[model samples]
Target: MNADIKNKIIKYSKEIGIDKIGFASADPFVTMKERLRVQQENGFQSGFEKGTLEERTKPDLLLPQAKTVISIALAYPSKMKNAPRSVKGDRRGIFCRASWGEDYHHVLRRKLNLLEEFITNMYPEERCRSMVDTGELSDRAAAERAGIGWSGKNCAVITPEFGSYVYLGEMITTLSMEEDTPIEDQCGTCNKCVDACPTGALVQGGQLDATKCIAFLTQTKTMLPERYRKKLGNRLYGCDTCQTVCPENKGIDEHRHPEMEPDPEIVKPSLEPLLTISNKEFKNKYGKISGSWRGKKPIQRNALIALAVFKEETSLPSIIKVMNEDPRPVMRGTAVWALKEIAPTAETKHLLQSFKTKEEAPEVLEEVEKALADLSSQGGMYV
Candidate 1:
C-alpha cells in the first residue's frame, strides 16, 4: 500500500503534466532559517515580505502536525520563436518563464489538491494542505531539501531535465513519505546570472534586492525612481536577465504550455497601447494576468519610461496628449518625462504650457520643469 501510494502520486503527477515531484521529512529546515534571517536583513524582498509568507516558510507554523513535505516542479517551455531571451543580434528581451502563464498558484495548487486527495484516500487518518509560491513556506528551500533540485545562485532551483525554468510548490502533510536527498550545487564558478543583471541588485551571492529588481518594478504601483529606469529596457511586467544567461539553461529542449502564451500586444508592446489602454480593456486583457494585477496606470508609466530609454521619437504625440488626462500623477509624470526625452515637438510645447500651470505634485512638477527645459534647449517652445 505504501509503495502503491508513492507510485500513484508519481504516476498521477506525470499525467497532470508536472515535470518532477519529491518528498522530504517536514523537519524544520535548519539552513532555511539562517537564509531567511539573512535575506530579511537585506530588506530586498519589499512587497513579498507581507502576507501568509512569514509562517509558510517555517514548516511547523503552517501545520503543527506536519511530518512531510512534497515538492513539485512544473517546467515553462523555453522555445521562443521571437528569440527574445537570447543576446545575439536578436537581443531577446528577458522574461522569466515561470510567470508567463496563468498564475501557477491556480495551476499547481489544483494539482496539490488532487495529490492530497489521493494520499488521504490511501490513509484517511492524515491531514494535508497545499500551496504554490503563496504558502509562507520557503518553496525553494523545500524543493532543495526534497532533492527536487539544487538552489542555484540565481535563487531558482534547477534540475537537469528542466534547467532553471521550473515553478515550485509544496504539500505539507501528517503522513511521512520516503524522502529524497537534495541535489548537489552545479552552478560551480558561474556568475552569469549576477553579471547579466542590469542593476547591481544581485551584488551578493544568492541574495537579491527586489526593489532594484526589474521584475518587481514593472508590477509596482508607485513611480519607479530614476536610478533603475535606465536599466529596465522595454520590460513592462517582469525581467528574466539572470535566467537567460544561465549556462544551465542552454541546450534545453523547449517545453511549451499553451496555458500562458504572450499576448502579442503585451509582448514588445508599443508605447501607444500602454498610453491608451482603457480601464475596461485593461481589465479584460489583464484581469487574469499578473502584470495587470496592479492595474494599467503603473504599467503605462513603465511603458513611457521604456520609450524614453529607446528615444522613440515617433510616440511623442499620443503620449504628450495623455500627460494631462491620466488621473494618477505618477502616470502623468512619466508621460512628462518620456515626452521631454522623446517628443518635445511643436504640439508638445503647446500642451506643456498648460501642464506647467496646473500640475500639483512637487516631484512631478520638478520633472515637468526639467522636461520643459530639455525641450526648450532643442528649440521646441516651452513658454
Candidate 2:
C-alpha cells in the first residue's frame, strides 16, 4: 500500500511541476550533526542557520512518527537569455543565479503545500510536515539521502539531470515507504571549484567557511570586511564562482520553470542608480526576488563597492552624493572608500577633509580620515 501511494505521490509531483522527487527513511543526520558542531566551533557558520543541531538533524523532533522523507528538486535557469552587457560607463552588479526570478522560498513552499494536500487526501490518518531552505532540516542532507543528488564539494546538491542548478525542498511523512539509494560521489579529484573560489571559502571538499563565502557575505547587513571588498567583484547579492567553475555544472542551463527565469536588467542592474534608490523603488523593483530579503542596504552597499572596483569615474558624482548626504553610516563610510578608489583627486581630498568636520558618526569619520591618509600617502598636493 505504501509503495502504491509512493508511486502515486511521485506521479502527482511531476504533474505539479516538481522536476525530481525521491524518498528516504527519516533517520537522524548523525554525520551532519558532527560536521555542524565542528563548523560552529571554528566560527565557520554564516549565522543564518536556524534551530539547534539536534532539531536540524532529527526529523522525528520536527514531526513525530515521521517514517519517510520525500525530497523534491526544481531546476532554475543558469544562462540568462538576452543578457545585457555591462559596459564601461554603465557598469552593472549581479545577483547570483539562485536569486534570479521569483523567490524560490515562495515557489518551493507552494509546491510543498500542494504535495502535502495530496498526501493528506490519500492517507487522511497520516500526518506530514514540509519545509524549504529556511527550515531546520538540512535540505541537501535530506535530498542526498533521498537520492535527489550527491552533495558536491562546492557544498551544493549536484543532480544527474540538473547538475547543481536545482533548488531543494522536502516533506517528512508518517507513512512508511521504500527508500531510494543515495547517489555515489561522482566528483573524483575535481578541485576546480575550490581552486577558483575568490575568498578561499570552500575550505575543503564538502565544507565551507561561510564567513568568507562571498555568497553569504553579500547577504550580510553589516559593512563588508575590507579584506573581502575586492573579492566581491560586481556580485551584489550572492556569488556563483564556485558553481560556475565546477565541471558538473558546466553547460547546464535548465529552463524548466518559467517562474525561475531572470530578467537581465533586474539581476544585472546598473551600479550607480542603486546607490540612491529610494526604499519604495528598491522594493518595487527587487521585492519579488530572494536576494532582496535582507533589504536594499546590502545591495546598495555592494553597488558602491562594484563602482569602486571598476574605478568608474562616471559614478563619482553619485558616490559623492551618497558620501555627503546618505543617512546610513555604512553607506557613507562605503562611499568614502569608493571615492578614494574611483578618483583620489584634489577635489576628492578636499571633499573628504571638509566632510570630516561635520561627520559626527565615528565610523564614517574614520573612513574619511582613512581616505585622506591614503591620498596623502600617494605623495601629492591633495594631502
TM-score of each: 0.89, 0.98
TM-score for candidate 1, residues paired by index: 0.89
Residue pairs with clashing backbones, model 1: 56-136, 56-137, 57-136, 57-137, 57-138, 77-255, 84-92
lDDT of 2 at 164: 95
Worst 10 residues of 2 by lDDT: 374-383
Model 1 over residues 1-383: C-alpha lDDT tens digits?
65566788889888877779998888877787777677667776766654443474567678878888999988776654553332222222233455555766777777788888888887899998787875578888899998888988787788888788787898899887777888999888988898888887786667778778888887777768877877888777777788888989987745546675654434444455667878998787666655566677777777788777777666666676778777778888888877766755777666777788988888778777777677778872543
CA-lDDT, candidates in order = 0.74, 0.92
Using lDDT as the measure, the top candidate is 2
Clashes of 2: 0
